[model samples]
Target: MSPTRHGWITTPLTAGLIRGALDLERTERGLLPHRLPARARAQCADPQLHMAESQPSGVRLVFRSRATAVELDTLATKRVYVGAPPRPDGVYDLLVDGRPAGRACVTGGATLTIDMATGTVEHRPGPVATVRFTGLPAEAKDVEIWLPHNETTELVALRTDAPVEPVPDQGRTVWLHHGSSISHGSDAASPTTTWPALAASLGGVELINLGLGGSALLDPFTARALRDTPADLISVKLGINLVNTDLMRLRAFGPAVHGFLDTVREGHPGTPLLVVSPILCPIHEDTPGPSAPDLGALSAGRLRFRAAGDPAERAYGKLTLGVIREELARIVRERAAEDPHLYHLDGRDLYGEADFAELPLPDDLHPDAAAHRRIGERFAALAFAPGGPFANGSG
Candidate 1:
């Protein structure tokens, strides 16, 4: 254990768990130890041994799925168990030392129960069903879980085997982020594969992912979510969704962003907030509100296609990434004078020019998994580092 972080601590309080929701199985090793429980000494060798030290502020896993499976392989030294009633719709990943030890599987339509009192997984498979694992290692690391498709799941709680006390954070730093589906992580491999999650991993900071899928309309609710959440660092990726959805008029777009940011400022005051405009999207490059859609393809199956906007629409009520980018730059510049902590990151900095040269979006809307990795790396380089580039003020 590094002195830089505290020993594993268990909480009398068990944060509620999320069940049956679609979640992907993946391993994330870079979580800050603040709220995580320290790995147990007894069960350190099991590859399936996974633990979440900090109980209250546990990790959240979001994924798309229909039926899910999670597995944790345990060693002889430790036993994983259930702490609370399993979410009726979902199953608990066998947990050791407050972390994911193994996987659980559940189907829709029936209730799955974990008898916390008896330490067992019980199920009545019906229109739906669930499976759970128990008796796992306390110091486990590797974990595998299955989740349903096309839905989101946030893992809010876990229990651990090691015993310790909570430690208050001594540093004054915050992290904030914003984005579209890619940032929201649409169809990118797994829950951990989301760019925001990846960036949060490398940066080592609290992540408030405001990456809404097809919903980053600079909406007040979106901004309010950011404003209401505590943050030391902030970033916003705007535009593509706006173009894709044709949600607002150009006249209303710029000021709405300004207003959304203004509201966030009211809550954060001194926090550093970065506003990111869209990366290039050839489909919406010159396009306007009426983005071309393939209704015929839609009628045929799940296949859909799009084309660029009319130049005339760009002249009128159209929304283009280029146009929005120009406005966002101007807004940030004007606001920076009033707020010294404010920063502006060209979305292209995360993925522009050469990036587009290598990985063009297949549908001309969303980036592929490889692109998500590239963007995550670029973001880590430009925004997050040891000295705390994204750490608000003084590192």
Candidate 2:
């Protein structure tokens, strides 16, 4: 059939064309993608988790279409820390037939400005913006629109010159992963370039990322979500968020890890499950946290994080990166005796002391774009290579 120049066809955004997110909520304006399902969201009242899950990290719209032009209408909620430099506009990455093709950005959207010192928040609503891509090959092809990883986007409409249909699964192994903001693409360039996305590309697997920024606190709801989601391989990067939030003591951490893994095993008894500790965060390695923003640096137009807890507090069981690494390794070792499919990867193996010496974390916390690339490549080789835990035919 020849391409038509008729009016744009509007398709309802549904699960068939969306990947990574666990649920979609119907809003007055459009569909909102959420990392956590409605059941999980209803159980938690933390504003942090609510905001993080809505950011759509590693989420994308995938379909087969012959459209020469596509336009997406979206309402984005972008965060801005008071006194910090304005963040660059979020990019929409377009992939056609499994190759990078084009990129575009939305102009206007709502803004949430937060005062770090006072814990005050102000919201400013902006109009919906349209992101359009043109001159796509006028033939049926697999298409993907990778949503912004950092901004909370409500997809209002999808308009194409030709009708779009969900792409059929290609029989690739599904890799479901959960972690903190680092896994959520904090300093990465774009959605598809996030470490997990990059690693997924290299490992040739379909990724469903549950990387909730600042919200990976071993929450029961998250573990339940993981248990219910189907996957050939699973990983949960633990520690940083728990320490930073100061949410639990060392005593609570052990049982939480076991409970999270137990719930997941109930559903995926034989699946390869990897437990990853946090990468080196210099500020929080020996020192425990409630990590606080470095107000001195922020005033000088730089953003940096600092650990507030004293090292002496370790005597009292405060958690730190060093302590977390030991605990995670011990847990995985003990569990592997009974569950052979279980494995542990010290995150430092992905970005260790030497790498840190050369490419130090720019903000004393999150890795820069370069570090993300290095970690992604290393993870692909370590976990997905032959004889490794996630090897293609190992199961």
lDDT top scorer = 2
RMSD in Å for all candidates:
14.0, 2.0
TM-score of 2: 0.97
Cα lDDT, model 1, residue 345:
77
lDDT for model 2 comes to 0.91
lDDT of candidate 2 over 350-389, digit per residue (tens): 9989999999998899998899999999999999999778
- Cα lDDT tens digits, model 1, 104-175, are 434443233433234355544333132444454433233323232113222322223333233234463456
Instruction: Please give the distance, in angstroms, between residue 307's alpha carbon in candidate 2 and its true position after superposition.
Output: 0.6
lDDT of 1 at 265: 90
Instruction: Report residue 366 deviation for candidate 1 (angstroms).
Output: 0.6
For candidate 1, give the lDDT of residue 319: 80
